[model samples]
Target: MSIPLVIFLFAWFVFLVIFTFLALVSVVQMLRFGVAGPGTYLSTVTFLAVTGLVLGGVGLYLAGVDWNATLDIALTPLL
Candidate 1:
């Protein structure tokens, strides 16, 4: 793979992992701790962080990262 492709893949994967982890943490805290054991704060922080990350990823992808063209795979017409 090209260097730019590798870099884009790495960055996109990192963003996905972070977003998934934060979302899971938020769900677990809400279901397990509610507002107790500092879970409330943690959940809030994770949710906000994930939101920011997703927004940033979208912006980066839209700014002409050619590797991001793969994202259309998710929206492509399936046979």
Candidate 2:
């Protein structure tokens, strides 16, 4: 029932990779196939900015964490 805290970091990394792929594909589709308009660029910029802020916050939060820690999870039987 012991889990390493670094596992969370690993999970985040996986999520980041997936998010990056999806975002790239979305932006490509918008710019390549969608209509030409200001809203397209605006949406792209907003999406990137929001993503940056979110990842930056996550980085700042993780900065102070000690990855060497372990979490003990206990499960009780439910009858």
Candidate 3:
């Protein structure tokens, strides 16, 4: 893999880890505070965590594929 691709993938991985950690912290806080107020904060944080995990998994999967082919397929509709 090229240096740039490697860097990009590494950065993506790092961000995923960071966001996951943040989500976990939010969950812990919500639990400690109990289901007070409207509970929207807990729900929103949970959704963000789930979305981050899904996107991170997809990013890792794509990292193993040929970038040219992936981009071509992804951008085909726009061309």
Model 1 error, position 1 (Å) = 13
Off by over 4 Å in 2: 75-79
TM-score of every model? 0.37, 0.85, 0.51
Tens digit of per-residue lDDT, candidate 3, span 1-79 = 2243455666877997898799778777776776665576768667778787888889798868764432233434653
lDDT-better candidate, 1 vs 2: 2
Clashing pairs in 2: none
In terms of lDDT, model 1 sits at 0.69
Best by TM-score: 2
lDDT of each residue in 11-71, candidate 1, tens digit only: 8779879977987776776767675766677767777787788778877876675663434
Candidate achieving higher TM-score, 1 or 3 = 3
User: Lowest summed lDDT over 10 consecutive residues: which window, candidate 3?
Assistant: 67-76
What is the C-alpha local distance difference test score of candidate 2? 0.89
All models: lDDT?
0.69, 0.89, 0.69
Would you list the clashing residue pairs of candidate 1? none
User: Mind giving the per-residue lDDT tens digits that candidate 2 earns over 7-58?
Assistant: 9789989988998999999989989987788898899899989989988998
Alpha-carbon runs more than 4 Å astray in model 1: 35-53, 56-60, 68-79
